[model samples]
Target: MLLLTIDSSAGASVALTRDGAPLDAWRTEQTTSHAEVLAPAVQRMMIGAGVTGADLDGVAVGVGPGPFTGLRVGLALAHALAEAWRKPLHGICSLDSLALRATDAGVEGEFLVATDARRREVYWAQYIRDEKGSRLVRGPFGASATDLPELPAVGAGLGLYPQELRPATMDEDPSAWVPDAAELGQLAEGALVGELHGVLCQARPLYLRESDAQVPVQMRQGGS
Candidate 1:
C-alpha cells in the first residue's frame, strides 16, 4: 500500500511508505517551523517518490499530545489531503511513534517517552519495552518535568527539563529527539492488518492544557 505519513508535533517529519516500510522521509529539527517546513517536506518526498496526492492509498498522521500550533498544522494538512484525495486516514498518537523509535534504538528497562510541551511542561508516557513491542505504562498526560518519575528518558522533553528529569542513560544525543514517520506508517499498517489494537483516533490535537489563544473579550461577552 502507498501511504503518506506525517508528524509535526515535535520536530516536523514527513514520509512516503510502501507496505509499511519507508520509501522516503524528511524531518526538520526546528520545533516552531511546522507550518513552514511541513508543506515543502511533503512535496519533496512525494515528488522524489514519484507519487502525487491522488496516488496515496491512505494518510497516516500523528495526532499529538503536543503544543497547540505545530500539532494543529499537521492535522489540518493531513485531513485536507485525505479529503482532496478521497482516501482513508488514520490518526496515531505521537507518543506511540516516539516509543516505537526508542525501542528500536535499544532503550531497555522502564522509561518515560516525552516531548517538549513548552511552558516548562512535557507530554509524557511511561513504557516497558518487550520483545513484541512497547506497552504504554503510565500516561499520555501533561505534567511539569519535576513531577515526572525519574527513569530513563527519551525525546525532546529530556533536553527541555534536564535540571529535573535525569536519564537512566543516553543512547544518542538529545538533539535526535522527535517523532518518527516510519513508525507511524508501520502503526497505520498494523491498524489495517489487526496486528495492533485500536489506539489510533480521529484527527484531533491532543492539547491537554488550555490553548494560549483565549476567546476574545468581545466574543466571550457575546458582543459579536
Candidate 2:
C-alpha cells in the first residue's frame, strides 16, 4: 500500500511508504516550527518520491499524547490531505512508533516508552516484544518521572531524567529518540493486514490532559 505519514509529537516528520517500507522520510527536532515545516515537508517528500496524494492508499498520522500545539498541526494536515484525496485516515499512537524502533534496534523482552510531556512530566507506555511482535501492554499515561515504574526506558523522557529511568540498552541515546513518520506508516500497514487490530484508531489527537490554554474566569463571565 502506498501511504503518506506524518508525526509532530516531538518534532515535525514526514514520510512516504510503499507496502510498509519507507520510500523517503524527513524530520527536524525543532519542536516549535511544526506548522511552518510539516506541510512543506510533505510536499517535498511526495515530489521527491514521484507520487501525489491521489497515488496514496491512505494517510497515517501519529495521534500523540504530546504538546497540544504540535499535535494539532500534524493532525490538521493529515486530515486535510485525507479529505482532499478521499483516502482513509489512520491514527497510530505516537508511543507505538518508539516501541517499533526499539524492537528494530533489538531491544528484547519488556521496556518502557516515554516522551517529554513538559511541565515536569512524561507521556509513557509499556510494551513487550515476543516472537510475534511488539504489543503495548500498559499505559500511554502522563505522570511525573518519580511515579513511573522502574524499567529500562527509551525516548526523550530519559534525557530529561536519566537518573530516574534506566536506558533500554547501553548504546541508547535518550535525547535522540522521537516518534517517526516512517514507523507510524509501518504500524498502519500492519493494521491494514489485520495483524494489528485495535491498534489503529480514529484520526484524532490522544491528549493526556487538558490543554494549557484556557479562558479566564472573567472572560467566561463576560466581564472582560
Candidate 3:
C-alpha cells in the first residue's frame, strides 16, 4: 500500500511509505510555511518516489494535540487530498506520534512526550514504554510545563521550562526534540490494519484546554 503521512503540529514532516518501508521523507522547520510549503513538499516526495495522487492508497495525518493553526493546516491538506483522490483518510494522534518516536529512539520507562505549545505551555502526554508499544499513563494536557506534576520524562525541547521542573534524566537539547516520520509510517500501519482506531470523527484534536477563540470576550477583556 502507498501511504502519505503529514505532520505539521510540532514541525512540518512529510513521508511516503510503500507497504511498510519509507520510500521518501522530507521535513522543514518552516513554522509559518505550512500553507505554502505543504503541497510542494508532498509533491517532491511523490515525484522522488515516482508516485502520483492516483497511486496513493491512503492519507494518514497527525491529528494534533497541538497549536490550533499548524495542526489545522496539515489536517485540512490531508482531508482535501483524501477527498479529492477518493482515498481513505486516517488520523493519528500527534502525541502518539511523539510517543512512537520516543520508543523508536530507545526511550524506556515512563515518558512525558511533549511539543512546544506556545504561551509558556506545552501540548503534552504521559506514556509508558513497553515491548508492545507506548501506553498513555498520565495526560494529553496543555498547561505550563513548569506546573507539570513530577514524572519521568523523555521528550524534545526540555529547555522550554526551568531546569528544575524538567525531567532530570532526559536530554535537554533541541536536537533531541524533533518528531520522527519513520515512526509515523509504523503508526499508520497499525491504524490501517485496524489494530488502532482509524475513524476521523473520533480522531479529533486532543486540545486539552480551551482555545483562544473559545475564550469569551469578557475573559479576554478582564484577562481571566
The local distance difference test score of each candidate is: 0.83, 0.90, 0.72
Candidate 2's TM-score reads 0.96
Q: What is candidate 3's CA lDDT for residue 79?
A: 87
Q: Compose the digit string of candidate 2's lDDT tens values, residues 42-158.
A: 988888889987799999999998999999999999999999999999998999988988988888888999999999999999999899778998989999989988888989898
TM-score of each: 0.91, 0.96, 0.83
lDDT value, candidate 3, whole model: 0.72
lDDT of 3 by residue, 1-224 (tens): 77898888777899988876888888887688788998899888888888888998888888777777777888889889988999988777776766766666667877677677788777777887777666777667887777776765545546566472455353334324656555576678776776655323343555666667776788889965
Model 2 scores worst on lDDT over the 10 consecutive residues at 167-176
Ranking by lDDT: 2, 1, 3
Q: Once superposed on the true structure, which residue ranges of model 3 sit more than 4 Å away at CA?
A: 162-176, 194-203, 213-224
Candidate 1 residue runs with Cα over 4 Å from true position: 168-170, 174-176
**How does model 2 fare in lDDT?**
0.90
Superposition error at 111 for model 1 (Å): 1.4
Candidate 3, residue 59: lDDT: 85
- Report RMSD for candidate 1: 2.0
